[model samples]
Target: MNKVLLQWALFSFMFGLALSLPLAAIHYQKNSSFKGIFTNYRKLKSAHLDYFMQALSAAFVYLIGFAAHIEFAAYILIPFIFGVILNPTILLLEATPYIRSGWIRFIYRCLRATSPASLLFAWLAIAFLFLPTYMTIILLAVILISGIGILTFLIKRRSRNEVGVKITEIE
Candidate 1:
């Protein structure tokens, strides 16, 4: 039963990650233009609101899952802390490139180079709201696949980056 659940969760995570990736990249790149990818200021406001809402919704779901599993706080905390650590680097990776340079940017860029690390961060966030071990494994696999998609997407964007791509980061 646990294995079945695990497999099902894996499938769910993969499906969601696969579907979300392209759309997100498209939306993000389009939004990168400060005009802001909306018809007007009103739409831009709504768009940002939507992003926040989606993030919140995901968080709520994760918390509920953690509630279900109810593990020792530390077990959940450690990965989450790592996730937190990775997350800012991701934000910095995404945001820093827009400005600044030198060692900090380079360092952030290198850390940002960790493809699935972002996906792992998401999985860590969801880990708290987990079920049995099978569910956890499935979540991890989803994270794994998400990492794959990140590298795949990045390579597709710039062929030069393809040379250093890692094995585990591939789909």
Candidate 2:
């Protein structure tokens, strides 16, 4: 009954459960010293919630599909595994001291560059399941804008480094 899919689904679920540790801390620390732990606590919480929900949903879908003898369950797992599991895992890792190391930062940058493509494709697949074509188009545009924004930020950061001038603040 597709044991491999079942195993991955369970793994996703466990990872979601693990995320609750940080989620609880974020919630409890919103007004305290630990509030500064995350640069954008609200956004982190939102992303964490998204990952938990999507992983939970994927687990259920996989379980149900296996029981029902459906062969298409793997397709449903792909997007959630990528967007929910992989993306948020990397974001969470950003909070670690080791992530600041050159190789780790490089990997993070590469992921930042490529993640939008994975997310866009995943969104496209999910949109086909539940969204109108027009809405899907709008989502695609949003994805494009987000990708452009990331690229712009990276280019600006690189250029700034190259110039040997640090602008404390720019508006």
Candidate 3:
């Protein structure tokens, strides 16, 4: 079940990335006033970029969870996937011509205010409301620590590689 979910997440991410080309072309034709091939249609451009990034981020999270054999796959992965899909779906709707309508703009405004990170936090908030508070806090802390560790390791590795290259050039 987890494997299937991860596969679906990968597919969704690729689909989101694939969506950018056609949307870019449409933007170019419809909203371009900047003497370029793409639109200055800021909101629409933002929608496509945000959707693609959110899907990609969700896929990354799913991959990490799968690789680590995390026990809470359903809890974490499901919300990530659902939010990734829903956020972009809302943005895509906003990209349509009817955004001038007050209701649609309002919806867009609300969703746009919350990014992928905030969506994850919102899930955490919901979980905290329902589940044991300690469990939620521990889970969040683990994720935070893991993120920091990974980033630190990556930075050190990058610096090491750069030093190695410099040494080789000098010798």
Instruction: List model 1 lDDT by residue over 23-136, tens digit each.
Output: 455456675444322234333333334334334433554456455664334444444334334433344234323325677666666665653354455456555345578987
lDDT of 2 by residue, 1-171 (tens): 345545655666677677667667767766654446555555566556656665665566566556666555455456545654567656665654546778978877877766656755655665565567898789889989999999999999999786655454341
The candidate that wins on TM-score is 2
User: Which 10 consecutive positions of candidate 2 have the poorest summed lDDT?
Assistant: 162-171
Off by over 4 Å in 1: 1-62, 69-75, 81-93, 96-100, 114-129, 132-171
TM-score of 2: 0.50
Which structure is stronger by TM-score: 2 or 3?
2
lDDT assessment of candidate 2 = 0.63
Error of 3 at 54 (Å): 2.1
